[model samples]
Target chain A: MASGEAILAHGSAAKRPGSPWLSGFVAATISEIKSLYREPAALAFTLGQPIVLLVILVAFDFHTTLPNGKVVPYLDVLVPGLIAFIGMTVGLNGVLFPLSRYKERGILRRVAATPMPTGSFVVAMIVSRLLIALAVTLITWIFGVYVFGADLTGSAVLLIAFATIGSLAFIALGILMVAFARSEDDVAPLMMLVLIPSILFSGAADRQPRPRPHRPRHRYPRPRHLVRRRDHPGRLALQDGVARYE
Target chain B: MATIPAPTRESASHTAQPPALRVANLVKHYKKFEAVRGISFDVQPGEIFGLLGPNGAGKTSTLEIVTGLRDATSGSVEIFGIDIAHHRAEARALLGVQLQESDFFDHLTLKEQLEFLGACYGVKPDTEALLGYVDLADRPNWRLKQLSGGQQQRFALAAALVNDPPLVLLDEPSTGLDPTARRQLWSLIRRLQAGGRTIVLSTHYMEEAEELCDRVAVMDRGVIAGIDTPLALIQQLIDTGFKREVVVRDATLEDVFLHLTGNTLDGVSLDDARKED
Candidate 1:
C-alpha cells in the first residue's frame, strides 16, 4: 500500500501513452497472482489434481518387459504420457475456468473499463497458470526420476518441444471451449465431456490398446524399409520411395 | 486500419479542450436487435450526470460503448479529447468505472482487491486510506465473498477510486442497496462531486436522479427521451399542464418503511447478510 500522493503520481505518470507498457503488464501479472493465491480451492485443485493422478499412476505400476531380458520401469513409460496428460489438463482447465468465470461474473467487463487492456490481462492470467503448470510438471518429472527410477531414454529437448506443442494445443482448445461456453456453469460440463474422451483415448492414455499388426500382401508387397501403417499416406509415400530406390 | 479515428478539429486547439466525455451517433446492433440507436451526449468536466431508464433501455450498452468494452456499429467516443477507438488505454486512464455489478475476484481480500486493481492502472494506492475512505478500513482482510451486498458495492467504489481519475462512471451504483445504504452512497457521490470529479451514472430511482444528478437524461427504448436538469424537466412537465388527479402525500410508503425500519446503513441488515447464504 502506497500513500495517496504516490498513487496520484503514478496515475499522472500512467496517463501518458509514452509510459512504459511493462509496468501495467507487471501490475496485471501481480494482480493475477494475488487472485490465484487467494483462492484456496483453485490452488488445491490445480496442484492436487496432478499429484493425485501421479499417485494413482504409481499405484498401478503397469510395467512392460523388454525382449533383451531388460525390464522397463512402468513410470518411465508413463512419465511421457503423464506429461501430455498434465499439459492438456493444465492448459485446458487452468485458463478456461477463470476466464469463463471472469466473463460470467463481469470481471472482464469491469477490467475492460480500466486502463489495462483485456488482452494483456488475459495474457497475464494465462502466463501465470502456465508457470504453475511448469512447476507441477517439474515436480512430477522429479518424482518419476527419483522415486520410480524412470529412465530418460529420449532427448530432453524433444520431450520439451512436444510438451510445449501439447500445451499450446490444449490452451487453444480451452480458449475455443470458453468461446462456446455461455458461463462458468457451461465450462465444467464441456470440459468433462471433452477431457474424458481425450484422457481415455488420446495416445497420452496409459497402455493404449495396440491395433492388430497389418500383414503385407503378395501382389504389392509392403516395403520392408517402410513402417507398416497401410492407411497412412506417409507410409505409402515411403513405400513408393523405397520401390523407386530398389 | 481505416477504422482509426482521425483527429477532430475541436481537439487541435490547446485553449478549447474537448469535453470530459463525448459520444456521437452511437449505435449498437446485436443481430436483429439495435440496443443503442444513434444516441449521443456530452458530459462536462465537473457534473453529476444521470441516465434514468428502466430495464432494457440500453443504458448499459451505451455505457459499454463509451467505455470501449463493446464495439458500436457506427459511432465515436472521445474521452478527455482522445478518441477511444484510436487510443483506448490513454482515454481509459482518465476514467474510473464502477460497473453495474459488484464483480470482483471472490478470493481476494478488500485490501488485495484494491491493490490488484490499482496495479492494473499502474498506480500504487494507499490501501489503508482507501479502505478507510470507503468505510471498510476495519475489515481490510475480508475477502470479497465475505462482504455484505452494501459492503461489496462500497468496496467496489473504493476500487473504482483507487486511481483517482477525473471522471467516474457508475452504472446503477445503488441498485441493490437498502434505503439507508442508498443514502450513504448518494452522500459519497456528492462528496466526489464536491471534489470536482465528473460522474456519470445510471439509475432507475427518480429520487436518486433528483437528489444527485445535476442533469438527467431520461432514456427509453434505446434513445434519449429527454435530457435536462431534473428541476427543468419537472418544470417543463408542469408548464405543459400535466397534473395528477390525486395529490400525493409528502410521506410515501418507502419513507414509512424507512421510518419503521430505522434506515440501516450497516452491513448487518437481513438482505445484506443474506448475500452470503
Candidate 2:
C-alpha cells in the first residue's frame, strides 16, 4: 500500500510513442483474437464443422455429374462451396454472437470510455474476424487439395480475393444483425434462421437434392453460383482456372 | 467545513484552478422518463466526492453521462477545464472509470487485460505493479471468469487505473466485498488521493461515505436532496431535533470483525507473496 512512488514511476514510464488510434486498433485486434482462441465451442463450430463435413463426404465416396455428363468426385465441387461456407459462417456467427455478448455485457460501453475511437474498435473486430475466417478457409483448401485430390485449379489468389470480399460482406451483415438484435439471447436463433437454409440450399452441403428433370429450378443466385459465375473479373479468373474440373 | 456551499459556476470562476469535475444542470431523458433532473455539483481537485443514493436515484445515469458513455438531454460537464460534450476523447483521457457491472474481454489474462486497456490509451502500464496494487499480482494469468466476485471487482479497479488518469469514477466499488477487502479498498482509495488524484464514487454504504468522503451529495428521485460534508449533514439533523432511540456502541460490527480477523486481505500479504516469487 505504500508503493505510491512505484506506481507513479511506472505510470510516467508507461507512455508509448504513437497515435492512440493506431495502438488502440492493434490492441483491440489482439484482444479479439485472444477471445476467439479461448472459445472452444465457437472455434469447433466454425472451423471444425466444415472439415468434419468434408471428411464425411470423402469417406462416403460421394460423386456428382457435371453438366457435360462427366462423372466427378463431389469433393471437387464441394471444396469451393465449403470454402465459401467457411467465410459465411465465420463472418456471420463469429461476428454476431461475440459482438452481441459484448454489447449485452457493457464491454462496448466500457471501451467507449477510453481514448479509442468507436470506429477503430469496430474495424478492429471486423478485421480480426476476417483473419480467422481466411485462415480457416486456407486450411480447408489445403486439406482438400492434398488429402482428397480435389481439383481447385482455381487461381489461389483469386480464391483468396473472393473469400475476403465474401467474408467482408457477411461481416457487414453480421453487424447489421447485431444492430437489430435485442440481446445476446436473440442472436443464436437469428443466426440459425439465416444459417440453416444457407447450408441446405446454397449448395454448400453434399445431400442437397438436385432439381428433377421436369421441375422448375429456383432463379435466385445461390452462393455456389455466385462464386462460380464468370462475369466479374475475380470470379471470371476463378472460373477460367476451375474450367478443367468442369 | 460546516457551511461550505456546493460550488456553482459563478463561484468556480473565481477560483485560481478549475474544479477537477463540474456538472451544471445535467438532465437525462429516456423517452418518457427523466433519469436525471437538473443536478449540479463540482468536485475540487484531490478530494473524494461521494454520491449517496438509493436504487433508481439516477446515480448510474449521471455517472454514465459524465463518463461520456451516454448522452445527456441537456447539460454540460467539464473535466478539469475541457468540455466533455465537445471534447469527449480528451476528457476521457483524464478519467479512470469503474462501472457498476464490470465486464472485460472474454479470454485475456489479468495482465493482458491491463495491457490492452493501457494500449488503448497509448501507454505501456506496468501490469505487474498494477496487479500487485490490487492484490491480484499472483493471479495475473487468471482470466476474468476464473475470478471470484471480489477478485473481479479488485481487477476492475486495477483496469481503471491503467491509464494513470487524474480523475477516477467508481460506481459502487465495494458493494459485494467482505469487510476486510472493503477496508483494503478504502486504504487504496486514500493512497490514490494522496497521489493527487480526484475520486468520485457512488455507494449505498453510509459508513463508507462517512469514512472516506470529504463531501457527499445525497440524491433521491433524480435530484440531490442535500449536499455537504457527512458530519454537517448529521449536525443539521441533530439541529432539527432528530435523535436515535438506540444507544450508540463504541465500535460497530465491522470493527469487531476486523479486530477478530487480521486486517490483511485474503488471509495473506500479497506483497510478501510477490517478493517470495
Candidate 3:
C-alpha cells in the first residue's frame, strides 16, 4: 500500500469518536495479544521479563512489611504491585511495540478497510489486555497469599480501578510510540528501551537502595518493590529492585 | 425506453422492495477534496456488478460506503429498501466483504479460522464442507503462514462465503495470484454467481473486468465515466466496428515451461520449501 493511504486509515482508526469503550477496547487488545503470542520471541520478552524481575527482587528483597500495618508475607505485597507492573509492561512493551510493526506491515490498514467498526477494533484491544492482566492478578495473589504469608488492604474496586487507569496510561504510551516509530525493524529495540526505563523508574523491582522519600512526594504512582537491606550482602542494585513492598 | 421484465421477486417479502441496491447522489469529502462525487447507480438481484477504477479513484471508498463500513459524507445507499446511513448493521448484515490485505493468526489452522468466522456469521455449517468448498480440507493442520498466496486468497474467499450472504464484495480478488490460480478463482466465482448470488468487485486490470463482470461501471476521479456491459463499454468507445488479429509465437516460453514443469495449482509439491530450512 502507498504511504498516504495507510496514514489515512491510521488517522481514522485512532480518531473514531464513537468507538465503544468495552468491546472495542477488548477487540483491539485481543488482536494485539493475538499477534504478540504468535511471536515466540516477543512472548519470551513480555512474560519472561516480569517473572525474572520478580525472582531477582525476591532473592535480594529488604522489605518485610506489607502495605497494611499488620506483619504480612512480603509475597502478598509483591503480588498486587506485580499486577500493576505487568500491566504497565504489557501496555508499553507488548501492545505498543507490536502496533508499530503492525502499522509497517499494514495490519491496521487491512483492518481499517473492513466494515468492522473502528470502535469495535479499539474495544477488542483494551479487553484483551484487561483479561490477561486479570488472570495474572488472580494467579499471583492465590499463590502468594496461600503459599507465603501476605496481606492486601486493597478493595476489589480499587484493584480494578488501578488496572484500568494503569492500562490507559500504558495504551497512551503505546500510541505515542506508534506515532513516532520510523520503521517496523525499530519497534523491538525502541520498545525495550522505553519499557526498561519506565519499569526501572517505577521501582518495579527495587532492591538495595534506601529510598529517600521524595522531598515533595511523587504525584505519579510508583510501585516500590524493595528497599535497603539491614544485614544483606546482595548488591545494592538488586536490593533497590526489591524496595516496593518495604 | 423498454422496461425490464418483472418475471419474479421471491423472498420473505415481495412488496416491490427496492432493487437489491440503489445509490443516488453519493458524495464523500475528505475536507475540501471529494473522493466520491455524487455518483449514482443501481444493481438488480443476482447481477455481477463491476466497479472498475485505478488506484485512488474512490472505488474502495464507494464500496466501503455501500457495505456500510464507512458513512458517506452525503447521499444515500439502499440495500433492499434498508437505508445504510440509518441502519448500518441491518444493511451490513446482508453483505460479505473480502479485502485485499487481510491477516489472521499464524498459529491458527485453516479449520479453526473457518469455524471462528462461521460462528461470527451465525451460520454453523459443517466445517469439513466449507473447507472442501475452498479445496483446503486436507491442509487443515497447516498454519496460515504456511500456505501459499493462492491458498490464502482461496481461504479468504471461503471465509467470505461462510454466512452465504446474498451480496459479496471482493476488492481485487486476483491481485497477486498466478495465471492458473487466477483462472481457478474466477471459475469458483462463476460457480457462486450461478448459484444466484450477487457479486460486486473492483479491479484495476481491464481484462479481469471484461472477462468476469456481467456489467461494468468505469470510474475515474471518483465518478462513473461510463456504465455498460464490458463489450458495450469497449464498443461504445468505437465509431466503426473493427476486427482484431491473433498471433502465435513460434515457441512462447510460458508454454514450454509449463509443458516441462506442469501446470496445476494444487501442485505445491513442485515449490514447497522445507520448514526447517
Candidate 4:
C-alpha cells in the first residue's frame, strides 16, 4: 500500500514532463520496427523482393541502347528503378497496411488513450518505414555493385538522397490512403489499384516496347519519372567523361 | 470477501481532497443519435465506482468521454481537479485506462508491451513488479496473442497501471471470462482498491457490481436510474414491496459450480497452490 501511494504520488508529480512527445515518438518508432521485424511477409516483400529482382534482371543480361548508339548494361537503369520500387513498396504497404490494421483493431485508440499525441504516432510510422526503405536500398546497391559488377558510376550520396525523398513521398501517399480506408480489408484492394498501375508504368521493368513515334511517352503514368531523371544526369556526366578519356 | 475495509461515501466526502472524478451534465451526440443524455456524477477519492447498464445504455460512451477518448457534446469532466477538455494530457497523466477490447502491438512480448507503455507515459516501470502484480511473472515473454482470455484480461489491467495512475478506468474488465476467472478478477480488483487507487468500472453483471463497487450508478436509456450503495439500492427496491418470485437462497448456481469444481485458476499449478498453503 505504501508503494502504491508512492507510485500515485510520482505519477501525479510527473505530469507532462518536458519532451514526453519526443519519447513517445521514439517508443512508437522502436515498436513499429520491432513489429516489422517479426513479420516475415513484410521482410520478404521489402528486403527479399528487390534482391531477387536484381538477380533475375542481371541474370537475363539485358542491355539498353543510348541515343548515341552506345549500348549500356541495363543494371545501371534497373538499380535506380529497383530503389524506387523498394521505396514505393516499403512506403505504401509498410504504412498503409499497418496503420489501417491498427486503426481497425483499436490499437490506435488504445494508444490514443495514453499521453502520447496522435501526430507523433503518425510521424513515427513514417520514420520507421523510411528507415527500412533506406536499409533495403543500401543492401540492393551494395549487392549490385559487388556481385555482378554493375556499373553505378553515379554519386552514392545523390542516390541515397533520392531514395529518402522518394520514400517519404510514397509514405505520405500511404497515409493518405489510410485516411480514406475504412478498415484493413479495404486497404488491400485500394493498394492493388494504386500499386498495379504504378509498377506497370514505373518503367522499372522496362519490358514494354518503346513508344511508337506518334504516341507520347509522357501520357502514360511515370510514377518513377523523378527516379529515372535523377539517375540519368549523374550517369550521363560520367559517361561523357569516359568518352573524352577514351 | 474483501480483506480491505471499503471506504464509505460519508468518510470519503469528509476528506479535504477533491473527488477523483467529477462529471457535470456530460452529453455525447453521435451524428444523429444522442448516446449520453446529460449525465452527472462524482466519484469520491479511493472509491470503486461502478457504472452498470444494459447494452447501448451509454456506459461505454460516458467512460470514453471521461478517459478523453471521445469529446462530450456538452458539459465538463474533471479528473482530480484538472478539467479534461482543456488539459487532457495533464488529466491523462493521473489516469490509467483499460478499454473493453484490449488490442496491443502484435510482436511485443508481455514485458516489452509494459515497457513500451511505460515509455509512452515518460516512465520506466518496474516490469518484473508489474508482471508479478498481474500474476504473470512466469510468462513475461509471452505475447498478448499467446495468452489465454483470462490472462489477457489480467495483463490489460497490469498495462493500465504502467504509470501507476491514481485513477483507473476499466470498461467491462471481466466481460468474457469464465466464472472462476471472473471471481479471480474480482479479487484482483479488490486488491487494487486495497492499494489505495480509485477505480471506475463499467459492467452489465450485477454480481460484479455488487462484489467490487462501493457505490454504483445504474444507467438506463443513457440516464442514471439510481446511484447509491448496492445495499441501499436493494433496500430501496425491497421497501417498494418488490417480492421475488423465487425464494432467496444463501448459495447461488455460481457457488454450486465452484463447490463442484475446485476454485484453483486455470494456469496455476498444484505446486503453486501448495506454496499458497
> Can you list each candidate's DockQ?
0.21, 0.41, 0.11, 0.31
Off by over 4 Å in 3: A1-39, A60-81, A97-121, A138-165, A168-246, B1-17, B122-125, B240-262, B267-277
- Model 4 chain B is weakest, by summed lDDT over 10 consecutive residues, at B1-10
Task: List the candidate 1 regions with Cα displacement exceeding 4 Å.
Answer: A1-21, A34-37, A65-71, A204-246, B1-16, B248-250, B267-277
Arrange candidates by TM-score, descending.
Answer: 4, 2, 1, 3
lDDT of 2 by residue, A70-176 (tens): 44556777888888888888899778988998888888888889988988988998999999999899889877876555767669899899999989999988998
Show the lowest summed lDDT stretch of 10 residues, model 3 chain A: A4-13
How far does residue B179 in candidate 4 sit from its true spot (Å)? 0.8
Model 1 pairs in collision: none
Compare candidates 3 and 4 on TM-score and give the better one.
4
Candidate 4 error regions (>4 Å): A1-18, A66-70, A205-246, B1-7, B248-252, B266-277
lDDT of 1 at B168: 87
Docking class of 2: acceptable
Judging by DockQ, tell me the better candidate of 1 and 4: 4
Could you estimate the TM-score for every candidate? 0.80, 0.86, 0.71, 0.86
lDDT of 3 by residue, A1-246 (tens): 111121111011122233223323434455456666777887676566555645544543324432332333344457677778777776766556556656766555544543455556555665666666665566555544443323466686888688778877786677677778877667778778767787678754553222232222324422323222332223222234442223
Model 2 chain B poorest 10 in a row by lDDT: B1-10
Chain B alone, TM-score, model 1: 0.87
Q: Looking at model 3 chain B, which ten-residue stretch has the lowest summed lDDT?
A: B268-277
